[model samples]
Target: MTIRRILIANRGEIAVRIVRTCQRLGIVTVLAASEADLDSQAARLADQTICIGPPKSSASYLSVDAVVGAALAAKVDAIHPGYGFLSENQRLAQACSAVGIIFIGPTEAQLDAVGDKLKARSHALAAGLPVVPGGEVDSVEDARALAEKTGWPILIKAVSGGGGRGMKLVHEPDQLAATIELAMAEAHASFGDPRVYLERYVASGRHVEVQVLGDGENVIHLGTRDCSIQRRYQKLVEEAPAPNLRDGLRADMHCAAITFAKHLEYRGLGTVELLVDCERDTFYFLEMNARIQVEHPVTEAICGLDLVAEQIAVAEGKPLRLTQDDVHLTGHAIECRINAEDWTQDFRPSPGTVSRAVFPLGEGVRVDTHIQTGARVPPFYDSLLAKLIVHGTDRTQALERLRHALAQCVISGVSTNLPMHVELMQQEEFARGGVNTAYFPWFLENRATALRDQRVAKGN
Candidate 1:
């Protein structure tokens, strides 16, 4: 069954991105926007728009009832919950199935399996994928015991958490019990799940993930992406294919991801995130994102595939059309998330209006954005203003293109992290490629020290 119309239950750049794909596929788009996003770029681009609820996510984007109800009312053949919000939600998938509307993602069971951190780890181990040493901690005593066994500097993570909301790093034994309690409370408040787990922290870990597309029976990987440049576990820069892996490591990672996806008989687009311990020269399964990722453009640039189109086709009950051998990866691509935040002020959200937004356009450059001149930067949603992606013949060429693109980007009215991207491009370690996850924090510290030294020299 072909999907004639799709209800995009999302907003911002991702929503716009989906709309563009649907348009190209000759599928009508119905945007289920909140009151705040009534005039959003997606709303303008879509064939039709329907108000789901108020600006608050609970009443709108996060509301399964609102989303499914809008899909029912719009008479759309499917609902695409673009990444974040309810993209990985099982209830939305179930509700869509109950209503005879397709959910453009993995099955409900798959979501449940991967949504819980512990369950995902179990599945990874079953699929012969190595995982970090850790286990579930149900109580303060349980956490303390696990901490003792896992050694110092362990991570206290919420079982149902992502984006670093309910994660705590405990460096010493004295911080174990209290940190566990705090993490549990924070997890409860954030994800409505109080369950927390423990994991041994790898000090020199790099964030790498494999992009896979499966149609229930067959799975094929697009390649790998290195998202090690992050702040507080939130990725800011991503590149493909992952640079500087030990011999045979990249192929092994791709195979592991495919094996895990096949074990689940996964359908639709997913990302198998892994933590590469640079010191150990090995990788461990982190978790799976059961929806299209924000950094997917880098993969698209290298593979020349529209991931959203593939997702819709899978939802339409289509089998895998492209085999692993059919997929050819070329060149290198890098993406910098341009967010409406003040990097100097602790990355505080700067929501107001985009008075002027000018993005670079030329060979080897692409910008995916919903914001334009005079657009309102609403405070209720993610602060991402655009994604600046560049591709070239190789990593060096990609880095050069990214540097020029960053230099050409201009956005005013709301303070953005453009300056941060510009400086990051010039950093020798980053330019050299294959920096670990801790590299960003180290860069920040060095930057601060340099500023202090400059101030002292200037007699300020």
Candidate 2:
């Protein structure tokens, strides 16, 4: 089952990342690109490239038939779906199999196991892991009744969702009915599934996840990552070996993640996300991503492992290269998702041609990006332009290293969230590792209010 050649059914930094790994492994790569990405970094790096369709993602990246057709036409041994678009689409995996091509991520059954949040919660609970106070509801009344038991400040989420698309937070009983109705409508439009569920909302919780690898037999964890810094439910910053995690609690969380992955027979690279109530020193299963996550570089920095290469090896039917006993974690790594968005405009997408792109340079600094001078930032895709990662021997060192690197980064002609990252690094709470999922949005609002007060005081 050796993979001689593979087609990347994706585009972006992730696609380029896969190309580099394939090149290092001496495997030929065929990049499947939309018309807008024909001149992308991934296209240039691939040994061969094919135009799948127009720039519209629906006709190109999301088209299972188009991706499979390209793979079959090229006679590739496998197709790698990089992190987004069709990455977790079980239909894409099935299509690949139907065309006699290997899909390098999870199998259809495995995808089904954790694809839906509600079902994933059940799976985690069955694996001896705890879950939040939540359950699927049939109607608004059902959600209202569950919320009453879960207490006020309940979260209503779409059963089939990610990135907080169909999620609503209801703080009082009077808001339940309207919130549930709106959430259901949003869910139906977003995922074509109107089902909703209610869960207890944690007042202060840290978003933590474990990096895991499975070979259809056993699963091993790389370590934990703290992704507490977020905005609009999107991760803005991530750090490996979560800082300030309680000693025994950290061990328990790791054990739970490993158990959950093994119970599902997870294959390839996946992330088991959890929400930890830091005050209570307890955690609950959130969801599982059955593909390489965007924040994987932090795990790689600390463990000194190439996750993508391991994914390919596993797809070739090779056992995991390292066992759990071999895992030796050291140092602290932090990653900033440098997106092409204007912080002044609520992180609105800044899609345009880059006049200059200069990232940081030096030891312990890594820039995973595809944009360069004159590169067009397509409007049809995610705003993520690059990932700025830094590593050091400890959390303090890593924080300082990241701060220095963010200051040095200079990507002109496109408004980015770099200012926000720079500002966050200087905050006392963030420096003390006291950040949680709500910290970023709160910081932004407070910062704006302070600026307005300053202007008023100056009689502007």
Candidate 3:
């Protein structure tokens, strides 16, 4: 139960992040890597490595049996499914329990409670939290009926989906049935679940979330994060202590998150996502992610906590060490997800051997990456290459530091979104902050229009 050794059932930057924490905690790390990732940075940093399967995630990272079997073979005391892959998987948690190995996350029941979008909504409502108006639809007729009640421009969402996959927007009644079928097919293909639900789309909403840790009986929130800068509903930039909130709004969000976590008697680390409708000046519960998030470093930066260490300690059944009063948030922190993608080419994935990799280093700057010169950027996995994080005394300083940091970053031999990040940091609206979820798409459209105008001016 002390977790002397941990099997890291993930790869890339997150795997490396877990390894660093395990090392600092004096815990030996065993990496459950795919054949394609055996030579990865995490594999190199880990005390030992085992090939779980081939390059495909289905045969490797996503396979509960493969991950647990590798943990058994390695004799690790626990398994850390960092962030993605099987991080939110209830079966993996149950499998760890059956094997007498600790899963550094929420319980199987908690996963079941929050894994389905509709179930999560019910729980949130039960916790006295407001939720978007919507319900599950079994057929096209059901969807149409719900859409009629929810009004036009409803969002069709998969029950078992995240990261924007299996989500569709319907702007009118004519697109209902076909959109329903298309959404169902996509949901089934992406999440192995055809079940979909509808929600009234908040036209001017900001994506915000609060980080909470619990020991099943006691819970405390670590403040809020703004993740509104996104493309296709996938966050590209995140900041801690979500900027431009009205007075008491941050405290309200934190309290709501704690209320929901206590209602579930939740344990371990989780993020309670919410949609803040700027026009209405109100917030609604979105869902709870029962695992570490990619943007966790921003919270860690401001709170001065090693979230991974705290997570492991909680898994060891240790009670909460810090009280709400003891926890202090001192500064602003920002994180940019640097991915191996050609943003100019519609964010196409770029996979190749890295010829050069350079990141900024200074006070208040942190770069979490698994890439190095000569490293292979595999096409089979998530395009994420690194997370660039920076901290400052306030939002302005953080933005300034982030701009300089983005300027210093350089990744070659594969197309990366570094250029896009640089431009985003300089955008006037982004600099002002508190942009809505639609802002990023609008930025893209505006950029395209500017490019066209530039082409015409060149011809003239």
Candidate lDDT (C-alpha), each: 0.95, 0.91, 0.94
- Per-residue error for 300 in candidate 3, Å, reads 0.5
Q: Estimate, for each residue in 262-295, the C-alpha lDDT of model 1 and write its tens digit.
A: 9999999999999998888899999999999999
Q: Could you list the CA RMSD of all candidates, in the order they appear?
A: 0.8, 1.0, 0.7
lDDT of 2 by residue, 362-397 (tens): 989999999889899999999999999999999899
Better of 1 and 2 by lDDT: 1
Task: Tell me the number of clashing residue pairs for each predicted model.
Answer: 0, 0, 0
- The residue pairs in collision within model 3 are none
lDDT of 3: 0.94
**Model 1 Cα shift for residue 222 (angstroms):** 0.5
lDDT of 3 by residue, 253-356 (tens): 99999999999999999999999989889999999999999999999999999999999999999998888998999899999999999999999999999999
Name the weakest run of 10 consecutive residues (lDDT summed) in model 2.
139-148
User: Candidate 2: where is the Cα deviation over 4 Å?
Assistant: none
Candidate with top lDDT is 1
Off by more than 4 A, model 1: none
